[model samples]
Target: MSKSKRLMELMMTVNRMRKFTVRQLADQFDVSPRTILRDLQELSELGVPLYSEVGPHGGYQVLKERILPPIAFSEEEAVAMFFASHALRHYLFLPFEAESSTALQKFYYYMPGDVRDRIDQMKNRVDFLTHTRQQKAEYLGVLLEASVDQRVVTMQYETKNGYSERTIQPVGIYASNGFWYCPAYCFLRRDFRLFRCDRMQSVANDSTGIEPLDHRHIHLGNWEEHGSEKPVYIRMIVDLSREGVRRCESELWHVPHMDITPDGSGQLNQNVPSSELMYFAKFFIGLGNEATVKEPSELVECMKGILNEIMAKYD
Candidate 1:
């Protein structure tokens, strides 16, 4: 085989084997050990993370972060991939922020000149807008890993009341409106709670020896089915004007329950958690006259109390 072909095959072979001796590769490729060693050296230079050991049991091993084999992409596919990563630029924090940046750099710089030019032109046209929140989710990586590993974590969480330490086993972490949220089972409340990632002051492994909950069945996509809060929900209905419908569409959680009329009027009818009625009150208040609560007396009272407080402030 040509030297290039041999190197490519060697890359794939070592990645698949993960742990193999120089002699093993040499025998498999029908090449001398010295030639295989030279090829391995070149692969290391090419950014393939390789670790070598000289003991009897130790040999060449790929590190935890393995380099993936190259795949050819069509021009259209390349553009799509570039835009997908580019869209994440709106968020200030990402679970894989550094890796995402480096990947985008590699993808852009390595593309053909024409493709790069096309991407440059398209950059001004298309965008994925997010709220661009100021708060940082510094513990996103740790929370994500704990969720995947089913490990319990203790965190100092700040709430409206104050800061407190709690043990939680996260189901998953998701980014919405430029902020990260972790839905986890909170041992303190003995229930599932949606935690704002920025509110977590510090996170660490649970030293209380609390067993982790099996949240494998719960995911961001289906946590609603489990319950907004212990399967308890209060029916909430709201009437919306055309402007309201447009405004509510920007909120991902409210879109599913919004029904629009041909005349641009709409209604939001959904079961919302009773504990969050105050939140709904604030949201509708922000809409001013565009939205009106039609049902749920508690929500109406909550809104009334808030408006009364504002009126009192003026008085």
Candidate 2:
């Protein structure tokens, strides 16, 4: 293989194995020890953080967290990737930051000088994120991989009550409000459910994978929401204020079907799952006096009860 491809393979190997000696890598790649040493040094120079030990118990190790293995991309695909990555910059604390950044770097390297210059000129003009990065979901990578490979996984998950173990067949993964969630068929629940990736302590293959490899085992409602609960129709009204506008945008991000008046007064009609009515109530209450719940007395009652508790603290 060419030296660049060989270097990429070497880096991938070290990352997967976590640690390996120069002799081991040399033998694996059918190269001499000196060549392996040279490649390791080259990788370090190219920004791969590698460390070595002198003793028999130690070898070489990659310093940072493991990202996806390197994959080549053509120039056209690189151009397309630049725009896509730019769009997702708002999700800064994305689980695959290292991998995506590396891919962007490769795209930049492959771009023609004029193309690179034109893109660079607009790079600062198009910004996605307003705030700083949040903590990344640690187990998102494992969940993502398992979903792709049809691997059933056992995750040590932290629920509302406490931590417990769950065997899940991941059907889909999504992100919203800065949190990542996986929709999976839970063996424990004997039903479809949603899991927060951040709340997972650990994830491992459940007996190699789901036997017979069935994707139909899990049922998800849409590309976004997950559940089989009956739908709840919500009617809400809002004031035409700055905060109202902001709330409208945020609510519209999740529930696009909500109808806003021509004068931008409020969202009139919304249909969400009964399971998510609490979520809906909280969203409206969060808008302060700018919002009003017109239908579903249960939601209004829930909001009133919560407000009463808050008022009781002062009175």
Candidate 3:
């Protein structure tokens, strides 16, 4: 093999072997021991974290952090990878925040000059925007690790009722609309619950020897499928004017359940979570006459109560 190919293969081989003698590598690569020793020196200079031990049974071994072998990417693929990491800069916290930054820097540092120039030129033109939030989900790494390992964790959580300690086995963590959420199986609630990551005051491994739920089948994408007994749902039917339909398409959660006509008018007929009726009332109220809630007397009553409070303020 050519010197470059041999070096690359040797890098991968040593990383996989983790510990090997120079003679072993030389024999495997059909190269001289002197050549293998020189290659090892070069790899060490390139930050491969090699450690040598002088004893009959001690061979060289890679340290805790192992360097990955180089992989070739097309120009387009390289740019796409760069922007994928760039888009994440908007988030305040990431599971691998420091590592992500370090990887992106290394990636950019090695790009060809023309590719770097192209990336610089396109930096301002393309962007993936998300809402900016100040609250940091500090335990995202812990939650993610628990999810992957399927281990239970104990955390002090800030709940709507009050602060409470919880033991949960996280299915996964996800980001949406500038917030991080972890859907986990809560031992306290005896069901699956979605916890906002920022609300977690502290997180640690469960030392009580709590048995973790079998959440290997669950993941962020499909945890809702195996969700616990769902909240009460209230049937809601609403008529939307053309303008209302246009607005709802952008902001309404039930847009997919809307029945639209040729004139762009639509009717939303779906069951909404009963706990969110007050929010729905406020939203429909903001729509003024553009929306007409046709059913679910509970929501109508809630809307009336809100309107009454507003009039009382005037009085």
TM-score of 3: 0.85
Residue range with the least summed lDDT across 10 consecutive positions in model 2: 217-226
* Deviating ranges (above 4 Å) for candidate 3: 53-57, 234-270, 286-297
RMSD (Cα, Å) of model 1 = 2.4
Q: Model 1 TM-score?
A: 0.90
Ranking of all predicted structures according to lDDT, beginning with the best and ending with the worst? 3, 1, 2
lDDT of 2: 0.72
lDDT of each: 0.90, 0.72, 0.90
lDDT for each residue of candidate 3 in 1-315, tens digit (9 for 90 to 100): 888888898889988999999899989999899999999999999889999999999889999789999999999999999999999999999999999999999999999999999999999899988778999799999999999998999999997899999999999888877888999998988888889998999999999999887779888777766866867888999999998887777666335488999999999889888998999999899999989999799999999999999999999
Using TM-score, give the best candidate's number. Answer: 1
Residue-level lDDT tens digits of model 2 in 51-129: 8778769898888655456666665666567978876667755657777887778778867898798788778776555
Error of 3 at 39 (Å): 1.8
Worst 10 residues of 3 by lDDT: 247-256
lDDT of 3 at 56: 98
Output the TM-score of candidate 2.
Answer: 0.65
Candidate 1: list runs displaced more than 4 Å: 224-231, 252-254
